[model samples]
Target: MDRRRTLRQRLATQRLSAAPLPRAADVVRLLACVQSQERDHAFFSLGLRSRDTTYAAVRAAYDRGAFLRTHILRPTWHFVLPDDVRWILAATSPRVLRAMSYRHAQVGLDDPAHVTRSLDALGELLRGRAFLTRREIGAAFGERPGLPSAGEQLGHLLLLAELEGLVCSGPMKGVHHSYALLDEVVPPAPALGRDEALARLAHRFFAGHGPASLKDLARWASVTQADARAGVAATLAATPGALEEVEIDGITHWFDPSLPRRTTAGRAAHLLPVYDEAVLTYPAVNFPAAPGHPTGGAVDPFWEPVIVDETNAGLWRRTVGKDAVAVETRLATGLDHEQRALVLEAARRLADFLGRELDYREVTGGPAADDAKARRAAIG
Candidate 1:
């Protein structure tokens, strides 16, 4: 396939299939591919939306025997389906653990003996409890014998326990955080040998996010290029499809040819949380913003509500007092009358999604605040 044609095809696939599809269950299953708790709020962005939305998705996946709360990828809490988690962890966890070894040393957990002691203490404290927030768990540890500074120590201990598959964040309890034992929560899936595990994960990655090269896989998985190439080779050897090469700016990249194409419908308005995987996982070459965006080099990876037109023309936020939603557009040049109308329509769609009457102001001729009063009047 021609390089430009292939690149276009990949972008098309991502625009269509990258987001949650027909069923919420399928979305929850795909969440396994990218979720990571160690990176802080990224986990919440994965599937932990409102209490109702998150719980429904989790319960559905759990009932179907999908895995929950394991150190699958990026050495953090990812809710992999039971069938997929074992091989994913086997293929991906070693690299993440190795990367974290230096962090372990820095946190005064360099010795395996020390790590084991911490895990034992934690496991004992959490045995029968359904869940405890990190703070509550730390307080419990403070009362234990031979443990000091349990609050600070708890963080390191939890990291070790999570990496070892001993504990994970359980279902949300009305916004109060909680954690549970893995064995009690998710039964083990059948195990795969190392080679089989690696091959399986690579194939899943390509199937889920195909038309991607080894380097893209490496960056997403946080593994070395060598390991990524080996994984890709193993996957391609087993699969029937041919590997196609594409060149961008004179650099060659490999991708699967059968990847889906982008659909233009229903993609204009998105309330992407901060660090949504759609924006985070793919290569930068795929979704280049309009030239001269104020946020500069690539879009700021935050949960600002984005308005996508021919390009990412503006960003929006909600706050108290003034208009519930505020919009700021970094136009390459000022929007003509038609483009401005489209932008307002996009803003209205965003307001509908949030279930609030949207009050919006266009940042024309200057910063948005300069014309805030007029913009609100226009919306009214």
Candidate 2:
């Protein structure tokens, strides 16, 4: 199996290289979860994957509790649908809590009773109000000794409460995101059994982000290796013939059975948001880069927006002025007229989403050049 061919197939299957979903929540629900460490970018992440989805529309869905942002897999913030949030947390939070123990101790938050008390305090405080910003929540703990609401411990405390399903994100207040009690934010979603939850997760992972290996699933879901295998087994049992195991370059990988055949003759080049799952999920596979050497060192794959032509081409970023949004691209190599036009088309869509005029620019003599050089050298 050619690696680039496999990646292109995976991208098309994930809807990144095909027609977008119909709704913002649909995008989130399809992926099961989206890494949302960056807020405004996360909005664009959904918008870029949807049919006629606007920034305003995505924000509205978020405001309406159609999807929620909180710590899920790997103790990082992810955008998850309301119904899936409870089951995901139920299965994974214990592991996350255990992982966070050392950090909690480092910040004097290792005491379970004290942590419980803090969760109780935040729960009571949130019940009295519709929502509270991080600062407001911090103030609610107001000089309370031994409380983990000061310094960086504040975020940790909030994360703990989130794991326990006490609080979650509220609508943005201007530029600030606030928090609300999970119980009050939306009705309780039905829970799933542990085995069922793992199976469902395994299915979603492969369905939306597949052609992956057990290692990829474990890393992405933050589950144990044993659990990852079990989850895959359960998924196979639950939906026979849904997954197909294929050997790529002598290494076994699993993917959905129903991926579209290779077709990239006329599709426009795609400039995806930073940490887009299309690029993030398969971190182990280096596309448009050398095989067996995923991106790292010098080029931070998580930091820049990915440019996808046939495969991962390079990175792009945008700067906003009063009249227009200036899109600066640092490609690994040059593009043809058609490919450049397609990239521009993507940038135009982004400008439309932000209601800004477009000012496209090509950066020179910077990291893009260096990365291209490095890629060429690696391939040679």
Candidate 2 residue-wise lDDT, 1-380, digit = tens: 66877877776776766767798888898789999988778888898777635778888889878899988889888999888888899888899888888988997788778878888888888885468899887876887765666687788888888887888898888878889888887687778989998888888888777788888888889899789888889988888897888777776788877754454335766667777787778666756631211232135542364455555555577887777998876554445666667777888988988888999886543454445666677679
> What residue pairs are clashing in model 2?
none
Which digits, one per residue and each the tens of the lDDT, describe model 1 over residues 1-380? 44345444543444432333444335445434645453223333434222223434444444444445555566555556645655666667777778888877876777777777767877776788557777777777677765534544557667667766687656555545467776666667778887766666666665555556677778777667787777667777877564555665565566556645554454344444454555556564444444444453345322243434434444544442333555444443433566656657765644443345677764432234544676577679
RMSD value for candidate 1? 6.8
State which candidate has the highest TM-score: 2
The CA lDDT at 272 in model 1 is 42
Q: If scored against the real structure, what TM-score would every candidate get?
A: 0.75, 0.89
Worst 10 residues of 2 by lDDT: 289-298
Question: For model 2, what is the C-alpha lDDT against the true structure?
Answer: 0.77
For every model in order, what is the number of clashing pairs? 4, 0
Off by over 4 Å in 2: 143-146, 258-266, 290-298, 301-305, 368-380
Please tell me which predicted candidate would have the highest lDDT against the true structure.
2
- Candidate 1: pairs in clash: 12-262, 67-81, 67-82, 274-303
